[model samples]
Target: MSNQIIVTTGIYDAIKETLRRKKVSIHEEKRLATELRNARQVLRRDLPADIVTVERKVTLKDHTLDFEHEYIFVSSTREKLKKNKYSILSDIALAVVGYKVGDIIDWPFKGGNRKIEILKVEAWEE
Candidate 1:
């Protein structure tokens, strides 16, 4: 998936607010800032139901590592990685927006690149 993503307007304000409130390091802040500005905001109802968006439960598999993880894309206020919730401000942008079920993500991980395939997209909730 491309770095540029689409964010539903319903969650835009919440994400923006969360981004402003989070006390992230410079590197993380920069990544979030770039992704934030690059996002194209649209109405929640107009957004494709199949696409990954805030509050959606996503099941992804790292093909290279042969590992899978399920995460709920949520605003910072609701983030709890221990509970599988992921914050949009943390640059899990691909897992949160634009991409749809069965889409493969070629995002870079710690040292090398990893391909992640979206297996499922449960409906989003507030």
Candidate 2:
């Protein structure tokens, strides 16, 4: 998709700072850089509430499995993948980051493609 991914200015800053100071693989650096280059940044107050942003608690349904799952989108420092806390830097989360409620996100995973429909997005209280 050619649509620009929207990122809150706060999130954008955090990601940018992380990229600057953290040591990561070239591939990861390229991915993060691409996100910044292609993003549309906005102030936190202007961020659409339905969209999945940092620290948002999101509920999604797997179209392939007919199963529901809940995850708290966090920074990589805080993610515990199996526990449903997804790092925004992860491939899965990155692919789905700008999605909003009712949006279908399709991404590659493991050995095949996976699809999930966003059911809800609860903005972070802090």
Candidate 3:
């Protein structure tokens, strides 16, 4: 079961914001990216291997726009948990955007690979 990975602009903003608050230096961006990448690789390595698929869709409601994608979790590493643990899945989700369904993606980590999916998306004007 091959999963689909969804990436959106908002997720990028969140990562940037989080990193900014943490005072991640410009040089650290590469390192952070690498860590994120490594995390995904770790997940793939530690989790069960499966082929998950994904679908992307756009929605309009009440003058609002939203995007959503769905995929399946094949590996135990894909499972969502509340506790903050250092894992590929978690790293990818935090670093990358729209990580919902299941899709294999390459993270910037030194040499990291991730399987992620974009579960949902929503856009609103402030």
Candidate 4:
């Protein structure tokens, strides 16, 4: 895979700011940095519908676990509730955001490295 990813300008800035304000593992930090390094930034209006972004319901297939799960990628903790919501700062959300459908990524989590595949993405609302 190429070392390039596509992300909206807003999402990119939010990720950088959130990372600066939070304390995360060095491995995650490095992964995020690498993911954003060659990012093709686009305006919100130009962001592809298939791309994962904040407030979007994303379906991820965990190759290591052999299961699939859906999550609403939220930009703030306030958006999270009992539902299947994932904060942008969380390892899973951070790893999947900015990626498009069919894209598979290996992310370093607390447990170990996991291969996550982007299966679907859809807009969501409160």
Best by lDDT: 4
* TM-score to native of every candidate shown: 0.67, 0.68, 0.27, 0.89
Q: How far off is model 1, as Cα RMSD? A: 3.8
Could you list the CA RMSD of all candidates, in the order they appear? 3.8, 3.9, 15.4, 1.6
Among all windows of ten consecutive residues in candidate 2, which has the lowest summed lDDT?
Answer: 22-31
lDDT of 2: 0.74
How far residue 116's Cα lies from its native spot in candidate 4, in Å, is: 0.3
Instruction: Give a tens-digit lDDT track for model 1, residues 1-126.
Output: 655666687666655665587755455455556767887787877877767887788888888889988878877678887877887555564334667777787655434566778889888665
Clashing pairs in 2: none
lDDT of 2 by residue, 69-109 (tens): 78789888888877788887665565567767888866555
Is candidate 2 or 4 superior in TM-score?
4
Off by over 4 Å in 2: 9-38, 81-83
Task: Write candidate 3's Cα lDDT for 1-126 as tens digits.
Answer: 223223333333444565767644454476455443433322322332231211112121211113333222112343433422222223333433333223333444323433333333322111
The reply for model 1, stretches above 4 Å from the true place, is 1-4, 9-40, 93-96
Give the CA lDDT, 0 to 100, for residue 12 in model 3: 35
